[model samples]
Target: MKNLKIALSLLILISVTSCDDFLSEKPDNRTEIDTPAKISELLVQAYPQMSYFDIAETMSDNVFDSGMPETLRKNEQSYNWDIQTETTDIDTQAYYWDACYTAIAHANKALEAIEDLGSPASLNPQKGEALIARAYSHFMLVSLWSKRYNPATAASDLGIPYVTKPETELVTKYKRNTVKEVFDFIEKDIEDGLKIVTNDYKQPKFHFNVSASKAFASRFYLIKGDWDRVLELTSDLGSKPVGKLRDFASYDLLSAVDQRLAYASSDAETNLLIVSANSIVSRSYYSNRFYLSGARYPDIFGTATSLFNKPWLYNFYSSNSSITVFLPKFYEYFKYSNVTAGIGDPYVAEVLLSNDEFFLNRIEAHVMKGNIATANDELEYFLSTRTVGYVPTDKLTEAKVVAKYPVIADEYTPFYTMTPVQTSYVKAIAETRRRDFIHEGMRWFDVKRFNIVVNHETTNKPVNTLVKDDNRRAIQIPLHASNTGVELNPR
Candidate 1:
């Protein structure tokens, strides 16, 4: 019995160590977090290292089966809407899930330290950052793992556990909160955090600065059907966000590598929050079988698809095959642990929040508020930035929007009600966003929120369809997490 107990204890220790947060590192170093500077440094890890761009993008309507021979299980699984079984691989949902909680742990530790130090007024910024970081991670967790937030059903929907405190026990089991409970917690954190959050960091873009905080809040409220709050949060960004938006026209001139780096660069005014994500998605540009291929590329990027009847200003590069094509958004920066061996981990600078998205959220808010003219104007201005040879004459009208996106009945059914005109305008905005954030994995959230059906075509097999309100819309909880007593989303 003694020997068996020892063996089991060792097994548990190994499992704990293998987990993302063993809670014994620099960020979680309880002793080291005695000072403010250390706490600030700790909060750096508060942003998730994992990338959801690939997973989300694949699951959305943006990518198609290229019929390419090269295969990545994660990409293929996501494209088919299958439960992602790969638990530890970068760019997988499970990795992202672990990454989120690992990030939350860092935030929780920092908050605990602040409380331990008597919660000085000087530590307000740190406290605010920590709270918001916690909220952001939890928000992401629920957004991806739980059912889309429906107010009527959210109270009963399963949410990822909202972990607010540092783990004191090694094998602490967690239970899933309901969607409403999770949102309530996230709202409380965001509200508390925003009240005291500051853009005081040396490199503010990497952190949840004032703009990033508002941008995040804009998305949260946008999902919650709080149109007025979304509009208010993003009000300062101005209707014509010329300088704040991405300079896609100039980006078109840069080299492919430069374009990749520039898209998520701190130098770019649009990128509000950037994180160095531990990801291999950039490398998957060509190797993955499921990808943005020539067949689907033209329909997405063609002039006919654009309301302005012009080519998009996006920088697209074809792989060596000229078969698997992709946008130059995610650029991998490798960090070598052993220089002599040429071994390293791949990292991509991912834009978590941006002014471009913030502006779109504003435009959508306008549409929801029955401000059709204002929404049209803003949408025109936003698209002009990304349209090739965009002239002032290329205008946007409700007529054009309706013609472009003639509402199919029951096509888009969000929680909020909309007029037929409003629905058309919203669909137009969604299409624009779908193109804008092609590789960013944001489209998946929209797919969930709008309850849009998706069809995936395979060369040999029959078409796989994800119908509206399909239970599979909520990605299954990671197996490891579920094994630890967290309930899985219903299949």
Candidate 2:
């Protein structure tokens, strides 16, 4: 509650026109943030309204949007794998370009204000927060609008400009940094920012408090293939004593408010960082359009085709009779008065980082480092929590894992053929990440990192296929971003 107190007050600081170029306008004079407290007020405004789920989740294979309405053009275009599915509304934009830069602008504003305060230790917290915020915003923008971070080609590949200062003009323009430069800038900010960010906040989950900051570090290190740093940074799991999965069987899904608990902001056990999300995150309308594909559809109910045809449903779920539906990893009941009566909620809060992701991060790091037994232990612990009565027998022998999940061998390409032990652990990490982060945009991140091939031929419409390294993976920069000489990502 205290987090929102300052956050909500300064949320009105977002005064830029959506249609205009990012950072094209200046903030109003009365709203100038001048002090450390005022910087916190403005820094909290650094989070974007919409997440990657609002835009690029369609590019991943987790969705089945055949059920979506024809009127939702952005969703439709993205579903069909259009490289340039541009939306006219900045508020509802698919790529979230304006929203990201607006948050960056806020972070820059906070950093600029702090610079004039005699470089005091009292402002370090705000300074640290602004640095991470700025780094995070640029990271998201670069990941979305530029090529995937291929180290060899990164110096040549285009990346989003890392904006550090507040904009002052109506037509300010910038150039794209190379992917390697973007990575350098983000790493520098995070490495320094984490050192300054202390565990001192009323609402730890809402702000990037110690736990969330470490989790962010883990993600950054994992992306960089620096596993040692990832483990070291996350050794202290901030507030949670144990990273346990939420037992859905104990939940009262029948109640709308109770059902929402899975993603509620106050839930500290599962989530490391909780932030306000786009209204589209709701289960209402386009939310549940998640197409449970033939390759990976856990049919808890007697629904569609699945590799686990027999009693696999009951094996995972302790009780599915009460709740006949299981699709999105996080969901709630919706009330559509004029449309189909019962739907899903459109107001679920977004989870930025979570314990489950860390668990997987550990598993991957350990496996890659040849700590096979430890990696298997991490996988077993995660499974025992997620599935009912899941017991590890014989340290999850690779042969046994392949026997149960042969599809994993193919889904995890190139190195999917790793010796049974390592391959099994990698597949386990991949599957858990997918299942845990359904509808949360993490799958898209995985898709980019893994270079997973995504084909959109599920619907009756024309089929669209994108193999690894396809240009579609790099979402197009908004035409307006090119305004005033800023270069557009090549289409």
Q: Count the backbone clashes (under 3 Å) in each candidate.
A: 0, 7
The most accurate candidate by lDDT is 1
TM-score of each: 0.94, 0.81
Tens-digit lDDT track for model 2 on 202-286? Answer: 7677677766777777887787778798778756642232545455444424333334445554654767777665454443222
Model 2 CA deviation exceeding 4 Å by range: 1-30, 65-71, 83-95, 237-245, 252-256, 284-296, 299-347, 391-395, 405-421
Error of 1 at 205 (Å): 0.5
- Tens digits of per-residue lDDT, candidate 1, 1-491, equal 00000110001101001223336644344355688877887888888889988888898988888878778888899998888888867889989998999899989989988999999999999999999999999999899888899999999989889998988776679999999999999999999999999999888998999999999999999999899999999889888976999888887667677778799899999999998888888877576778888667888888899998988887677754556677778777667666678676777789999998999999999999999999999999999988989999888888999999998999999987899999999999899899889888888999999999999999989999999899888888888888999987887
Per-model CA lDDT versus the true structure = 0.86, 0.62
Any runs in candidate 1 off by more than 4 Å, and if so which? 1-22, 25-32
Task: Point to the candidate with the largest TM-score.
Answer: 1
Give lDDT: candidate 1, residue 292: 81
